[model samples]
Target: MASIKQREDGVWRARYRDEVGKEHARHFALRRDAQRWLDEVAAAVVTGQYVDPKAGRITWDEWTREWMERQSWAMGTHEAAAVAVQSVPWREGQISSVKSSHVQAWVAGESKRGLAASTIKTRLNYIQMSFRAAVADRVIATNPALGVKAPRSRRAEAAMRILTAEEVREALDAADEFRGFVEVCVFAGLRLGEAAGLQLRDVNFLGRSITVARQVQGSTIKAARIVAPKYESERTVYVPDELMTSLAAHVTRAQVTAPDEQLFVTPLGRLWNRNNAAGEWRRVRKDARLPDEVTLHTLRHTFASNLIAQGCDVVTVQRALGHSTPSITLNVYSHLWPSAEDKTRSATASFMGEIRDSADSVRTETEKPQVRGSRYR
Candidate 1:
């Protein structure tokens, strides 16, 4: 059946039933638009190029459940993707009938809603990727979320606070029972989950390198759930000899002889989380008189800064911090690197010094020019 009608809300509605007996309908502000939409649907029905328009009407909650079931990905990535999608405007809306204008409006709306541009960018990526999948599944003709304009959020170049060697010593002293865990975080640049997930077999005492392959899953009170590292975070980071000795002692004291045994844990022997970091963080923050803004992640920034300050290359620091690329490391810590002007100045000065040395050699040869002249003559 085909019909067009004007409703009390001053809108035109068009309805059609496909050959499969599936009904599709849409509303428009004008009878012309309704007629046009119906004509397009009629043409599609005739040539058999039409997909079920009603398929796009599935609620986001329903589609998400189905889409999630189809995805086999790392837990961390799945969580990230889920968070990114749920943050969007259409999270609870029908997935069909979404348009490029809707996505653009969402980007602008998110910016006005106090979301950072970087966060908006991430959310936009998730939607675009999802719509792309919808296209492949014949759920939509095009990805409505692609090529949208979003706000650009560039972080300030201000450097993070780095503990001096003396401060590090005091912080370690304040850690007391949790000192071993703090040591690895500050020295090895592991994320909190990675630190919590540290196992006996991952530490290579002979090589002084720690292999990071997995991270602790979140919010479990029972058996520790291990998952692949975040964002291609698997890497081998070498520790200094001083930290190596501490790790050796830590292993010995923890009685970790088994490969799967966790090297660091709460006093109760359970894995650590933000809520259960114990008084170790509190005591260290208090006794050390550290800045209130400094959290465990600050130790990571400190480690990266220390590495760059000591002339470690960005790639090495990127691997150590488990960043997906060196560009990320550079983006976050580029200000700490030697300025291009400084490098140019140093290079020019070295070249001038070499030129002066050559000039001196020529001066001596000029005095001996008569000798060479005689010999060649």
Candidate 2:
């Protein structure tokens, strides 16, 4: 039974037992207001949607740290999120009090700070994921980030540059020690981490395929550790015979002592990370006469572009790039897929020619019947 009593100050105090039989009291100026609050509390308890008001008092930074600790994200993902969190003032604010407008404003601020669109998207993802965790814990009703947009400004719309075959040849020629590494990237579309983590056992020399099963990821290049391929990108990708030959020569020169040894590494066998061959990569790009903006990752986009120009299917490209979904692959490289303008003309011509042939055959049959005096007549 609910209880309503007039206090010494003449305010009405309503007392009620919640679902767990915990007593809670709230004061109101009028008896009816207290009664209304009690009724709403009863309804909420019956609906199993009741939330403790104090549960969401924790700051966003605390909750995000808790949630991040519970997640088994890769080291690179963790590092990226940490970098974004450092700049977020909302991390110190209450998680429940954050509104959609606040998130939108924050995204706009990040864009104005000259952060790239991709980096801003990563920050937004961190925010969205934290809010989603709060929702799962019943600390908040919804995720504010769901309604927010990480604006992609004009500066973020640079067109992707694909290297020509001559440029690829020149880069490989100047690559010197890193030639095999560059070849694998341009020829097989292997990500830097994936290429760095490749072991001798994962390659099938006779089959001419490299199985991507692991990758290097950590806070620092020298301190990196091996983990499973990103986004479940573990799959087999075939390389050309010439690339296979190059790989073989590189491995032989490396003097690999163990079949399980990593294929590419320093002369002393210190495992390679993205930074290990930076000097070699710079020299290769410069000697090839490529622009300063051309990074080693540029080979990945070039690989996809070349495959698409050669009429590779979307699903195949998605698999090759280890994209989580075909839509992701399409979103980045959809334009590369052949529009087949030449094929469109050929298709129309073939259909019209078939119709003409059918009409001619019918007309000849009708004319022969009348011209030769039909056998039936």
Candidate 3:
């Protein structure tokens, strides 16, 4: 049941008892507005479908913490997810009350703050997913993120910064100090965490492959405990003969100090930090006179792009990258397909030609043969 009352200040209020026996009230400036709200509330109550707005009243911070608590992944990734979630524009306000306009404004602000498009897109997606979950849980009537627009992402073709073969050699040559880790990243395409967590036992010299089954995290070397790979699936990546020789030479030079020593470690025998790797890459890039935008991960991209450009199939690349699906590989590297434009043009021209030929044959057959033969018979 709902009713409208005019206050002494001439403001109208719509007060109602929802189907759940919860009281809700809203202030309106006009009588018509109050009446409209009252009518809607009454209808919802009568239909036994009234949902309490308070149920949706959670802050972005609160909901993200809940999500972090419930996630069932490796601790390293869970911590990463939590960090990403916390980086959003969280404030002491109801998550459901966040409108599409608010999200659009936030995105604009983030762009002005110079955050990368990829990072902003990722955060926006996480918030959108959080709202979606809220909607599914009946905590909100509708997801405010349903039609919200994210910042325009850079096109893959435009954003790709794959290093050339000569540039790769130069960068690798400059990174001779961390050559083992760099070699693994370049040849095996292992992620930074995977490379940091590599142990001697994980390498099978006889099998000519390395197993990617763990990752490392945190600042302290003592905190660098092993966790499963990103997808929780153990897989092996083959190493090239030249890279194998490099690995063997690197191991002999480093000299194993512990029974279970990590394959790539700092001079102090600590796990490598991605930031440190990136810093080393910056120095190496300067030494090689490469462009400023190039980083260590460019090596991985270069490897994948080279394979794709050389006619390696999507399935092979997917396995090498430890991707769960061929579609994932294709979506990321489809821009590397150099002949896409030419192939599209050729296909379109062939299709049109076929249509033209069929039309001409139909016209000739229809116009020529029918009349005289029937009259003679």
Estimate every model's Cα lDDT from 0 to 1. 0.81, 0.82, 0.78
User: Tens digit of lDDT per residue, candidate 1, span 1-377?
Assistant: 88999999999999988777777789999999999999987786576556676678886666766787789876656776788777766667888867789889878888888986777887778777788887677676667877786787665454367777887888898888788888888999988788888899999988999989878875544534677788789999999888889988988888889998988888788888644663468778899888776788778888998998898998888988999988998888998888999889999999999999999999998887453346655
Off by over 4 Å in 3: 1-20, 23-35, 42-49, 76-80, 88-90, 218-224, 257-259, 338-377
Task: Give each model a TM-score.
Answer: 0.74, 0.80, 0.79
Query: Which residue pairs clash in candidate 1?
Result: none
Q: How many pairs of residues collide in each model?
A: 0, 0, 0
Better of 2 and 3 by TM-score: 2
Indicate the TM-score of model 2.
0.80
Task: Write the residue-wise lDDT of candidate 3 on 276-311 in tens digits.
Answer: 667766888898899998877777888788778767
Clashing pairs in 2: none
Give one digit per residue, the lDDT tens place, for model 2 in 128-222. 88888788787876678896878763331256778888989999889887787898889999888888888988878899999999988753556
Q: Least lDDT summed over 10 consecutive residues: which range in candidate 3? A: 42-51
| Candidate 2 residue-pair clash tally | 0
**Looking at model 1, how many pairs of residues clash?**
0
Error at 228, model 2, angstroms: 2.0
